[model samples]
Structures are given as C-alpha cells and as structure tokens.
Target: MAQLSADADAFGPMLTIEQAAERAAEHITAVAGSETVPLAAADGRVLAADIVAPVDLPPFANSAVDGYAVRFADLAAAGETRLLLSGRVAAGADAADVTTENRAVRVFTGAPMPAGADTVFMQEDVGLDAGAVILPAGLKRGANARPAGEDLPRGDTALAAGRRLRPQDLALLAALGLTKVAVRRRVRVAIFSTGDELNEPGTALPPAGIYDANRSLLRALVTHAGAEVVDLGILKDERESLVRRLREAAADCDLILTSGGVSTGEEDHVKAAVERAGELAFWRVAIKPGRPVAMGLVAGTPFIGLPGNPVAVFVTFAFVARTVIALLSGTQPVRLPGLPVRLGFAYKKKAGRREYVRVSLAPGPDGIAVARKHPRDGAGVLTSLTETDGLVELSDELTSVAEGTIAPFLAYEMLTG
Candidate 1:
C-alpha cells in the first residue's frame, strides 16, 4: 500500500476496497484530548474512560408485583394459614417491620420488601377477610421479588472505553445518577466542494452550472460519523484557492474533505493542491462507481478527496471516509455491517473490480429476504439511492450472480450510524 503512492509509473494497479480501508486505518490516528460533558450532550460521542457502577442497580430488595409480603415459613408450615394485616407499603415508602407470627404486609410494585418478609403473593391470590388474610396454596418461596444489584452491581464496569454513546446508554447513565460523563472530543472536519460548474442551491443556474450536492451530502455523512463539520462551502477549480483553504483547515481541524477535482485533468485542483500543501498518500481504488478516490495529509491533518458524482461520493464515503473519521475520533475502525440475503434478480459482471448495486428487499419464495437491484445503475443516479433500501456488495472474483444466490447486503441505516 505504501509503494502504491511512492512510485508513479511502477504502480501496477488500483487497490481493492478492503485494501484501501486497511491503508487508511494505518495512516489515521486518534486525537488525544477528552472532556467532561452532560449526559444530554454525550450522544454520538465516544467514551474516553470506563464507566463503573457507583451503586447497585435498584439498590435494595423490592417487590416485582402488587402483592402481599409474608414470611414463607408461615405459609409453608401447615394446611391452612391466616395472617393479620400489618400495614401497606407503596413505592418510595418505608418498609414495615414484620415480627409477629402469621402477619403480612401489603406491598405494591417496586416497593421495598418488609424486613422479615421472604416471599410475596399476588393480592388477588389471597382472600382478605375482615382484619385477617387467608394465604393461597401452591405459593413458592422467594417468588415475585427483585434482589439487590440484579442488573448491575457496585464497582463493576458498566460500559468500556471507546464505546459510542447511544440513547439507551444515556438512560443507563441516568439510572446511576450520573450528570456528566468523560468523553473524547469531537473530531473537527473541514469540508468543501470544487468545480467551476458547481453552484450553491437556491441560486440561479448558469449556462452549464448545476447545484452542488456533494458538500451537503458529505457534511451530513461526516457529522453522522461523530465528527463536527466545518463547512468551507464551494471553491473554484483553481490551485491557489484550494491550497489556501487546505492550509487554513489544517490549522484548526483534524481532517479535511474535498469533493471533485481529484482525477488527472486540467480542471482538477485537489490532487495538485494537496501535493503542494502537503502529500497525497494514494488515489484511485479498484471499485465500480468510485474508482478515483484520494487520501493524503494537509499540514498534518488527514485529507480525503471523493469523486464529483453524488452517488459516488455516497458509496466511497460509506466504505472509506466514515472508517477514517471513526479512527480519528478516538474510537476503533468499524466495518460496514453486512448480512447475507438471497438475490431475486440475476446479475452478470466481469471479475476484476468490486461493485455495489443499489437494491430493495423483497420476500423470496422461501420467505427469506431477497435483494432486488434498482432499475438504474448509473453512478450519477441520485434517485436510485432514495428508491432503494441498501446496497448489494459484489466481490472482485465473483463474475455473475444467479437469481437465488446469497450475497452480502449493506443496509442504508447501518451505513450512517
């Protein structure tokens, strides 16, 4: 992988998608800083330290249902047993001390069990007559009770470091009465789009100009990968402007991303600007719809250059850019989630490069998930992404796929999260 960028003419061929990802992971490193933030602000952030349970979950033994708390010894002794009604305990109320023989205490769900009670019976199962209660038969000991630390005990590791915080994690932290948590700092990313024919949205289009869609698409994807985006807007296909932005972004950002102007053409400035400002590590990957991807460093800040096509930007970002961003954010490299799905449509291809086809899922004859390729397979077809559910990844060695072949499927929801 290193030799692929060092020698120009000696380079044999483009690298595969897996090879590109491995090289990118080796080149990228995590930021070293961390901060303490409120739990509300910790969503999507990676944990910098292990989270230990400060106290036992549910801290005390409690009742799991609305029932009568009693001494199992009293119920186990004889044919028929009756107990005197002592008192009622609701959730958050103090537990009553039961000492006298054949006495029971009324307990509601989540209420602390009485000091001398060892069992519980549903209120409907026992008959309450006047001042005494007739306990039901066939009641088991230690039933309908939640013991202390049933979920998590004190001093135990609740969550390990490098784990991405999600909504359910916030709930768990809140349950432990944690107000703030230590987390790795968000990776700051500087992003821009290049091309003379690209214009901002809501503006009048020139003779051959089209609105820039790659910037918005990449910005959203970067932010979704747990990085804060610094939008540099659109730039012309000029080396001077591109170099200036690269230098400025390197000063404050951890990484830089540019769409378009990566290929070898007179209008392409990203490749030249990166070479002048710093170093372009490698370019050109052996993958369909996104063969001209570029990666490098600008003043020590990681840089990734994606193709100008909207769908190309999408596919390459899912496989390459997102993994780099994860590593840069003090976390582990996460591979795209893949599942096996039967193909409902037959497809043929040459066995040289990897390809990803937009597809939707349908129920096969055997009631299994089937991948149905979208009608449009063009790299510039943005509508195809919206119409499909995910992507079907084809390997470089497999030439054709039969209608019932089981292939790898990557869902759109997994790509962003």
Candidate 2:
C-alpha cells in the first residue's frame, strides 16, 4: 500500500475526469500476485508474463484450398498447360511422397503442399484430361498456397503481459500447444451500500424505504471488471456501525466500494466513518450524474464511493471504479474507444463538466448511424441505461450541440469486459 496525497488541497476541490483518473493511477498500483491456470479457465484473466510462440504457426507449408498443386515454372505463359497426375495429398497426409516434376498433385485444404509445388489451381479453375490436370497460365505464383509461419513466426510474442485473455487469445495459445498460462490473481473487493432508507430486495419495503439497487448493481459491475466481491450488504447511517464494517472489510479486501452516504447531506455518515477508520478525500469531479465521488484509504485498502442514483452508479463505475480495479488486478488500462455518430437531437450542457447523455442509435436516411436522446434525463432513471445503445459524450469545453452534429458515442459493449 503506497501513501496517497493526504492534502486534499493538492488536488483542489474540483478536478477533471482525466485528472482524477491520473491521481488514482499515480497512487494505487497493481499489487496482485500471479497464478498459473489451465487455458480453459484463463478467459478474462490478465496475463502475468508475455507468451512467446514455441513453434511457427502452420509449421509447414500447406494448401489453402482443395486444388491441384503445381510448380509455377511448369505452367505455360498463356493458355492452359496439362500435367500428369503425380500423387494425392489430403489433410494430415505427408507431401514428401508426391512426385512434382512436370506433374500436378491433388491437394486439399490444410494439406501439406507437395515438395517444390509453388502454386495451387482450384479444381473448378482447371479441367481433368484422362489422369492429368489442366492448369491455367494466368494463375499467379503461390496462389492458394499457405506458407509456413504465415500467422506468427517461432519465438515471437504471441500475447503480451498485462493482456486480459479473451476467447480468441485462448485459441492462439492453444494453437501454440499451451495448456496453461500465468495470469494475475483476481482483485478482491469488499462492496456495500449505505442509507437506512435502502432495504433488501426480498424484504417488504417500509413507507419511506426502497430496495437497494446500488448493491446489486455494484456487485455486477465489480465482477464484470474482473474483481471478486465480498458483499457487506447495506449499512445504516449510524457512524459507529459503518466504521466497524469499514475496518473489517479493509483488513482482508484489496478495495472497498460503497454507494450513497458520500454526499454532503446531513444524514450522510460514510464520510465521517471512513475518516475514523482511515483517510478520506471528497473529489468534486466535473462529471454529470456523478460529482461528489469519495475516494480514500481504509486501513491501507483503497476505497471508492459512487453515487446513489442507478444511472450515476453505472456511469461512475464504468469510468472510475473500472480503472481502479484494472490497476489493482495488474491489468493494463485501455481507454474505451468511442464511435462517431450523427446527433438526431439537439443537446445543451454546462461548460467545464463532462456529461454522458443516454442515446439509442438507428440508421438514418443515408444509412449512417443517428443517435437519439433518451426521453428522460433523470439521474435515477435505470431505463435510460437499459433501453439505450450507449452514451453521447459531451466534452467539458463544449456547451451545446445542434442536430446533425458529429459526436463521439460510446457503446455499452465497449464499457464492459
């Protein structure tokens, strides 16, 4: 655990999204240990070391199509050239047994190319004349023939360290004959929600009580970010109980996460409870839906407090908590790439604060994507997330956007693992 900036004034009262992200990255570092797991279970786990290829991909030259393997020199410059059938090679068969002089060998896809064969003519492109095959002169050299090491050469890096393995990465490792891989251990996070008004989902709600959606939302978001969750359930506004839980969670968890009770409301007790346990900093990030995000250390464990609104919780988790988890899990952080889309509706926002507007996309008259704003703009509207394709990001410098404006859009798929 490294010492974070204790002076809140050093970061100022308000920070940009980029500045907050940089501060978190500077303070919290990857502390996860490494473990070797079988390839089948390695998906979504970050690599601990680079994976070097042990052998050349497609170790031997092979045919790319079911065709006749022939030497380029044996074909005529124009018209067609007929060659006697030498031998046949199917997938998994040896090509050394074929005779290649002034003759063509029948080859199938993935079959090793016959010795000295430089080209392949698809069976449909040539005619067979009584135990011989006719090859067209126009066929280029090495056509339909796959060379050895075409995909990756031996000793080359197959995957880099810090890469979160996907299904396709698993295929590449499997092709290199790897059964297991070394990856960073999953990050352990203790999560909970605050406010006595928050009730369990299964229990009946009191007059002023609503079911706690943030806890379930946080759990899913944390798990999707590749961190294990220790659910602490909901904590009331009592400072003593909150302090006790925070200390206990920080003792074993790598990160502590909570929703609500971080704002400046009189009833909010999480801020004081965190101070009793450890250090806490209230960051007024220039972002809509979520602004009063609290971050600090609880008994040496990093802690993050997201907003109470469901939409705010989703937005903040995607941008803030997601980055923190990536760092703690030893995974390389990747910025979510946004796609350019034409705005179908006009929008206005305050300057110096980044805002994410929920939008659904549809093809316009010209077949280009047109982003339409969600009907409701409330921070607590969960349907704004479920019914939309993604968010239209409004930068801090931009105050207004007119219809037909080209905006950077981030799809929901890009935000999740």
Compute each candidate's TM-score over C-alphas: 0.89, 0.97
lDDT of 2 by residue, 17-56 (tens): 8888888888987875899999989998999999999999
Where does model 2 exceed 4 Å of error? none
How many steric clashes between backbone atoms does each model show?
Answer: 0, 0
61-171: candidate 1 lDDT, tens digit per residue:
899999888888888565657888988889999885545357888899999988878788888888888988888678778898887888889899998999989999999
Best by TM-score: 2
Q: After superposition, how far is residue 45 of candidate 2 from its true place, in Å?
A: 0.5
Q: TM-score of the candidate numbered 2?
A: 0.97
Worst window of 10 by summed lDDT in candidate 1 = 1-10
